[model samples]
Target: MKPKQTLSWKPFVLSAAVLLILFPFVYLVLLSLASEWRFPDLLPSYFGLRNWATILGSEAGLLESFVSSLLISLSVAMVSTTSGFLISRAVFYHPKKNTLTLLAYFPYILAPVVFAACLSFFFLKMGLFGNITGVIVAQFIIAFPYALLFFSSFWNKKVKSYEDLVATLGGNRWQTYIKVLFPLAKGLLLICFFQTFLISWFEYGLTSIIGIGKVQTLTIKVFLFIKEANYYYGALSCCLLIFPPIVLLYFNKRYVFKKLV
Candidate 1:
């Protein structure tokens, strides 16, 4: 009876927690859609799809920014994830990998804006300033550290055990990777790729600094709208910024449930 009671409460508590966490996003959607949501009111005075419709249409260069954001994020994800996976493999197999892993943590600890400032001079020298290619490269700086960290977790004894099993079955390193490692880590790899994409997608400081305002990502667009006191469009852009993360959350939840099942 006691165990059953505890189990029953768990679902209720988790559901409440999930809703509590998601309420802000719900509010943001309402706020974006609310044409005149004045203060001291629990609900909006008026509600319409005008914001979404406008943002999706030819208003404020949003369509262009949306496409640019997509392209940059996808490109950053693939490049960063692939390179991180390759480099992490080498580092993980190295005898001094512990030291290397410790070093990798250093770069991510700095605030991105500050890091961007530090790299600005070098970017100028390399003629990467104001370049979309440079923006990708700058964003990679943030994504790569996270990528290395993520891939590191996938390289423990459990993975090593499989490697050993493959070796025993007469497989070399490449065969082991193609047959065992890649297959086993495919789900994790996909997650890592998307995580990198999210990082690049939301990045503002690095892109602004490196691209020198030439590259206008959705994040930049959001800030620009906010700077102009256009909260409606800002909220609209905010929706675009957050939508992918929600999709990502759904993917992670589904993946976890599948693993559990």
Candidate 2:
């Protein structure tokens, strides 16, 4: 007869950690599907798609908010990433590169609320207040600098050598970027876009202050739901919130990270 096999604790530990991480998401989904899930209940009194069905009508407005947030975040990410990549190259070759790089951190020097307060006057003067455009521009201000700093590290001595070699091979400045630089920095660019997208997606203080409560991104909607003590709607909104990031993560891991590896 064989001796009894010992049970390994590693699997149990990993399973516990994974459950801890996933519990909030699972609870959110369940809560979104539930009604009358009051205190002291091991399970919800009712759990179905009733709460989710609200998104199909004007009652919830979550669908609109989700679409608005997606558009704003995608715009901010694309603009910030492209501009940051192009401008950082110029900064890399500037006489006062360090000074300009230091200036890139200016937006981060203040809390988002204070930063938004300081910019409110200009936004109002430019007729950007209480609108989607204003929210995009405001988020850009915060995300752009972050993208700038992120891509700044991509321009270094090795990149310079590649640029020189490209020039030697009869490549123009544009050709060097299109052929060599862009391809080499493909992974970094995708990562930066993802980061900037998340930054804009979750931005609240600046969005609220700059938008003057008119622009309702998902983040703002989430807070509104919580403030009203509507847990069902809040959980539903949160489910919508994490959906985009998870998709991005899946694509990044499958395409960008695979190529990177």
Candidate 3:
């Protein structure tokens, strides 16, 4: 018998893909750490943590922006996940499941900017515009569709069967949720949390429109830095922006591999 040949293309393709994704970020980190990276320079003239220091110190409101971003993102994650989980459950069992499912995709499909535009008038009317709480509400509204779709996918035949088994075992709704559903869907819930948090974190269009520029999250800060020709600060903010998601992705990947093992 002839020995089997290995696929030589796979590794090359995968490595290229990884580089494509990571190279920009590597450059961003380099730029962020650089004090001066002028034209024609392959590397920075001065390397220091000045940008980081400036952002972290009271010199800029970045620390305050970071806190605000954290509060908003965390709150959006909690609200979107919890509310979406509950809403998905109802929609899954609803008599008008088809209509509701179709409706659930609307917000997600709409261009976030256009959606924000259409809602801006209503936000004004409801006194949500320019308020941090209002921006949170807008993010939740925008993120709900994604959460709904995600959790809706969780309630498949197998999940339903397990749920029925719990019911047959005399587990009440709360008991079933706490014991069965919670453990079963824990990873998915975490994914949803991260996704929704990320959605809220990187949101510029919706926050800008809804907050009326009053609430400046990290995304806003990055844009502000760029608009003001502060490229070093912009790069620093970019690094900060990508840091959490990358960390979460790494941990999630590790957890998945551990589970598989």
Highest-scoring model, lDDT? 2
Q: Which pairs, if any, clash in model 2?
A: none
Model 1, position 235, has a per-residue lDDT of: 84
- Order by TM-score, highest first: 2, 3, 1
Task: Estimate the TM-score of every prediction.
Answer: 0.82, 0.90, 0.86
Candidate 3 ranges with C-alpha deviation above 4 Å: 1-18, 161-170, 254-261
The whole-model C-alpha lDDT of candidate 3 against the native structure comes to: 0.86
**Backbone clashes, candidate 2:** 0
Tens-digit lDDT track of model 1 for 1-261: 565534468889999999999998988787788876667888777789888888666868887888889999999999988888878988988899999988899887888888998999998999889978888888888889888878886787898899999899999989998998889889977877878898898899888888777888899999998899888788888888899877888878656433222
Candidate 3 C-alpha error for residue 193, in Å: 1.2
Q: Over the full model, what C-alpha lDDT does candidate 1 score relative to the true structure?
A: 0.84
- Writing each residue's lDDT as its tens digit, candidate 3 over 116-151 gives 889999999999899899899999998989888888
- Those runs of model 2 whose alpha carbons end farther than 4 Å from true positions after fitting are 1-10, 253-261
Which residue window of length 10 is worst by lDDT in model 3?
252-261
What is the Å distance of residue 4 in model 3 from its true position?
Answer: 16
